[model samples]
Target: MAIESEVLVIGGGLAGITSALAAADAGADTRLVSYKQSTLRNASGLVDVLGYTPGGDGPVVDPFDAIPSLPDAHPYRTVGVDTVRDAMAFFDTHAPRYQGHHTDANALVPTHGGTVKPTARYPASAAAGLASDDRDTLLVGFETLPDFNADHAAAHLESAGVPFDVHGVTVPFPGDLRAGAKVTRYAGLLDANPRVSVD
Candidate 1:
């Protein structure tokens, strides 16, 4: 079979997906191709614009402000700040679950590794967990999943000088899945049983 597309985007990662979507939105026949699973499959789903500069002086407070200072050879510099802003706006319009574009400042999001990352856009569900929000937060980790240690994450957040009181708790998951199960397996189980509760 022969396939024809006005815009053929290679790969299925975030950049490719965004390009394909943009083309489609512009009334073009777009096609996306990927050899393997999407890289987003293992991603945290956060849209990071610029986290830090090459100097590694500190986290970026505003991606737009920092982008100009990036090295000339950097992708952001080559694309220009306005193009980056447009790309983020396009992402915001397509991804309704993500909340961003209201401000130029970056939001500090707590990661599973207990480290806080600065991102321009993030899932709406994680709004409460932003380090800028000065509310007591509780991080819950699964006892079966050894990759994330909630208590350790909380301690790390505190040590990093977060503006909120954070605590961690390890709880048993209400399922028969083994401790060594992959994240996809856990996600599948949860999708199959949304009401699964720990007694």
Candidate 2:
């Protein structure tokens, strides 16, 4: 048996979902097929445009600036930097309607493992956690949540020479709800109400 759609997006990863949505919004009958629920559930929910300069050392600051330096085979190199910029623009405009927006530059954000990595765009919620030498920060963790480690993240960020004052505190989830789970589980809240808040 076979199904039909103007665009058939295989895999349910971030890229695939975005592609399917874009195609649908453009008036195409798009369909998505995924082997699992979501490829992003375990993800840090960060958007990384470019992490490195091909095989070069260090991370990229302005991804657009580094585009010309990319190899021909790279996705950005093939589609052209303009495409990336346009996509970013799309996210920037539409993201607010879904509780997110495209960040201007790469940011150092923590992961579920309490490690930090550079990413180009991030949700407004996680954007504030970027490693900054200039901004003072207070890191907090939930006692019930085993996924996030405040101490580990603080140590890692401090060792990286984040200039801002850093501190950690523990918080509790409401009522008997100890899930303290990843935000991805509540993704529907965005669709249900843009103004919805997540803790």
Candidate 3:
């Protein structure tokens, strides 16, 4: 088959789709193709600018401030800080309204795992979960769902020794969870089970 466009983007991942849309927005006819699937379907849905470097220390507080300390050939340095800012701006213009801590500070966001990681921008749904000294929170997990570990997460937050209280609860899954089942099935149960969310 023959497909024609001013701009052709290979890969239907997040990057490809964004680039295609951007090109179209810039008045260019764009076409995107992927052999397998978009990587977005397998992503954690968190947007992080930079995490710890190879064998480096803990997560970054202010990614921009730590940029200078990175190797001279780092990708962020190569892209230039302005480019990163522009990308963030473009994303914020879309859905979720990506937000951060202060102007250049990274926000603390919960991961699928038990740990809290730093993200340059996060969805508004996770804003309140950011690490703070005065936010009492509850972490809940499903018994059959392996995506989240409530006990480990709640314990980790408490061990941080912050001035906040953490509680963890393990609840049974509303739907039948089978081996190798997709995570979306679990999420569908939550959306369908009015008793769970409305309580």
Candidate 4:
């Protein structure tokens, strides 16, 4: 059998894009599938990769600095320290140049201002801009206590001169948050969306 592609992504979120680009750069024909235009339209858009690390130029959180506590049975737990270091280096090398740029050289750097910085390269400004530029954005609002109404988000997008398609999703809830059933429900919603198609 011949190798078809270096990577085949099931979802078209930041992870998928980055993976596809990396694979394609490595000379691979990547295919990405998603329920919506891309994962950028969903809650993945709201992702904030900021978090505290123990060893850094800024302050550290000793408690959170601890590595994965998963048992040996967990595959991720087997990752070597060198692998993690190499990944961090790759991220540092690819960080956006404007991230560290500042208006006042004397003032603190905006990127370094916050105690917690983003782990992902996708900038909030860039994500927001993409959402704005794209027409007929479909924001699937979940119908629950913290439900996000499609019309509400649509209106805000409209005022910002952004076109959108809105729909509300009714997620099943067992009414037990601590049990962790909600996680599966949300995953199901994303799985239901399809790329190159509309719901």
Best by lDDT: 1
Tens digits of lDDT, candidate 4, 5-88: 656887777677667666776788777777767635444222222133323433222211333643565333467445544554
Q: What order do candidates take by lDDT, descending?
A: 1, 3, 2, 4
Off by over 4 Å in 2: 1-5, 97-104, 112-114, 177-199
- Please, what are the lDDT tens digits per residue for candidate 3 over residues 57-151? 65877777776677778888888777878887777766555566346877767665546777887776678887753688888877777767888
- For each of the candidates, the C-alpha root-mean-square deviation to the true structure, in angstroms, is 2.9, 5.3, 3.7, 14.1
Error of 4 at 167 (Å): 33
**lDDT scores for all predictions?**
0.87, 0.70, 0.74, 0.42
Range of the 10 consecutive residues with the lowest summed lDDT in candidate 4: 104-113
Which parts of model 1 are misplaced by more than 4 Å?
A: 1-5, 191-195
Tens-place lDDT digits, model 1, residues 4-85? 4598899999879988998899888988999889969889989988888888856889889988888999999999999998
Clashing pairs in 1: none
lDDT-wise, the better of 3 and 4 is: 3
For TM-score, candidate 1 versus 4, the one ahead is: 1
Over 20-104, each residue of candidate 2 has an lDDT whose tens digit, in order, gives 8798888888889999688587676666778777787557777888888888888898998889888977766656632223445
TM-score of 2: 0.73
Error of 1 at 129 (Å): 0.4
